[model samples]
Target: MFRAKNLWIIHLLGWVLFMSLPLTIVSREPDANFPMLVLKSGWFWSFFLVYAVLFYGNLLVLTPKLYLKQHYAAYAAVFVGLLILIYVSQPFEKLIFRKFRQEQGREARPEMPRGGFRNGPPPGLPPGEEPRPMPERGRAVDFVSLTLFIVAWAVAMAIRISREWRQSERRAILSEAEKAHAELSFFKAQINPHFLFNTLNNIYALAVSSSAHTAPSILKLSQMMRYITEEATEHYVPLEDELACLENYVELQKLRLNAKTKLDFNVQGQPDGVKIAPLILMTFVENAFKYGVSNHRESVIRIAVEVTGSHIQFFCQNRIIERREDVERTGVGILNTQKRLDLLYSGSYDLDIRNAEEVFTVNLKLSGR
Candidate 1:
């Protein structure tokens, strides 16, 4: 609304400046009569009305409906018609000015001498001499009118085209933002179900054996589920909250591991005031436990996270022991996490993964808020 009001103010100022030129010229005359020469003149009022219609009609109607629509032939036809109207109407100013001069001559004339020649040469003129007629200003007036008409037409087209271009650019930016939002939502939906499925299977194994750890595992699962359903729905969560959730998950996974499996988890630096994308770090740790643990052969899995100011660093490595088929399924979660990082952090994060023969490693760095 403010922008529209400003545009109207600009147009009003421009027309006022254009109308001032004639007033300035008339004021320079020796016996200038503002009311008789300008205010009462039919030509002055007609010029204002006609050009106003031309400028606004072209800007609000013709340019958008015809020129912008690629109807060049129809646009040209209408423009030529307006020019013809201007040409035909040019004679009005000349006729009005002539009538004013005749009235002035009658009012200023002195009483003629008795018996003197009527409508003849003046007293000082030589015999057989007639006065020369004043030079005509009709051509000059026509030229000025034509020039102003062209200027108004050009300015109207320029303004309309510029406005259209800006609106198009705004629409394009809005469309891109909406598409990115939808893609990020899809990735988060995939991560939630994948995490839940793996954790449930571990609890089922403990329940079959009637281990004492089974009851405690169920309590920890409830806490994790509460975090997922409530806090994880947000795009970003406090670093401390995410860390607590991760600790709960690690403890639950430990209940299913044998003494031969060695696992190390570590965190460095204070998490105060730091924020990170929800559930962004869980996929890598889950992959380590799924493929790196063994019941008979010795196995090791390591995970570490460090925070320094707004920067976060994560590293995870594990000895691969699962079958080839299981290792192939690991790509699903990792791929989805990578896409989420691109949409959320884009240039602010980096991730590297290596699947060697004996060990698989993941290193990720994030610039957080």
Candidate 2:
């Protein structure tokens, strides 16, 4: 967007260039007295003023109010009317020039010698021949005036159309950004409730069993909730903060695990200066716990995260002990996360999922800014 001051500066510079065009043409003439020509030629000054008015009128009013609004007949009528007005008014300059020439002739007559002929042939002319009358310059002047008028009209139209195109492009970009922001917020809202529902269920099981780990599980839930409400509300959070939240969630899930279930969680790398989209990795961990744990049979779930500078690699694998009845309903979290990834990471991240008969696996890679 151009600031008001800058826009005015552009307009001023454009008009300066427009006004200099006449000076440029005049400078090419032999023995041209530029200042005198400009001062004596009232028609040239009037021409400049008329075209200046026409340029602004077309730009500020005619184009926007008539041509752009599809008032084709009215715009054409107005254009023809202006042309007729110009043609009719131009002869007044000829009259003014003729009067000026007569006055100069009258002033010079008294200075001639008493016996000298007033209308004699020039010295270079043949003795019996008369000098040819100078050709009328009106046709050339009219041609130049018409050309200027057309140029003024074209320049106005071009500037207005170009500005309108730029503004339209900017508006489209802003609207798309706003829409993406709204979608990301909606997806985050859905994720929060879904995550809370599962965590509360885990805490409930511990409470009903009267297990000694119930208090610690509740404390972990409190910390995770605090992180969600505070740090996770932003589009991105520090990698260490997200890892701490995930660790709390994992510990809470461990309270319900029996000796028959074995889980391994590992993380390697310093997380300084690294950040990621919040809660993007939690859904995979939640799925591993939901269907991979068994009370009476051997079960194993593995989760690993490796961070190197601005790049992160995550892996999760689990044995599927319980089969899902409604595939669509069970895949909601995954779908939601995928949408967020598309919006946030776009082409900067990769995700792969494998669902085998006996095992489920997820591999994700992220490149952070």
Candidate 3:
């Protein structure tokens, strides 16, 4: 509202300056008689009143009604007609001034030098051509009017076009933001159900055996579920909070792994003030545990996270168990993670996966906004 008010104030001041030009500088003369000067000034003010009406009428009314509605030909025609009316009215305006001077002459002297104010068109003009010479005062007024008409029309069009462009850009930004929010919500919904199904299977195995680690495992699972349900719904969570959730998940998975199976997880640097998308790192870690561990043979799985002021890097590596089923299931989580990365971070992140020599390694890097 304040911006709108400021615009109106500027417009009013500009028109006020245009109206005051004739009284101040355009009509002022040092040597002219007092009555003649008044007569000359009247002619300028009369022309100015009509010119101002036509200029503002086009800007505020005709431009919006016709030009904005795509009626370009009609808009041009209307303005041309207005210009023609202004040009034709000039002679009648000069006739009014001539008559006033003649009346003053009857009361004052027998003959008063009229100077350059001509009763008719200049001599030696070709057919259908405009008069070459005019009264000094009338010529100055004509020049000012023509220049002002062109300038005012150009300025009004420029301001209107700029305002429309800004409004269109704002609408596009709002639409894109809404679309991203909806897509992120849908992706997160997929992640939670898939993860919970796998975690529940692990807990079922522990309950069937009546293992000592079953109670602790359930407690850890409860904490991780709370994190997923509460914190994961948000767009960003503190890096420290996300790391803590990762720790809980790894601890829960340890119950299913034998002593011979190595599951090492480490953090390298401080994660005090950093923020990240919640649960973004879990897919790779889950994939590592699912296919990288075996009860019969010794298996090694390693996960590491490094943090700096500007970026965070994550690494997960696991020896692939020689099983077709395990290999196929691992690809599902990794593919979903790639989709999420594209949707959320796009150009601000990097992910590399190596699946060769019976070993799988996943590396991810995320830069801060």
**All candidates: TM-score:** 0.80, 0.82, 0.72
- For candidate 2, what is the TM-score? 0.82
117-169 per-residue lDDT for model 1 (tens digits): 56786778888766554443345456556677888899999989988988889
Question: Looking at model 1, which ten-residue stretch has the lowest summed lDDT?
Answer: 91-100
- Model 2 regions lying over 4 Å from their true place: 1-4, 27-33, 36-45, 91-141
Off by over 4 Å in 1: 1-5, 21-46, 90-118, 121-141, 326-329
In the range 264-362, model 2's lDDT, one tens digit per residue, is 999999988999999998989988888899887788999999999899999999998866654564598789899889999999999999999889999
Each model's C-alpha lDDT? 0.82, 0.81, 0.75
Cα RMSD for predicted model 2: 5.1
Local lDDT at 356 for model 2: 90
Which of the two, 1 or 3, has more lDDT?
1
Give lDDT for model 2: 0.81
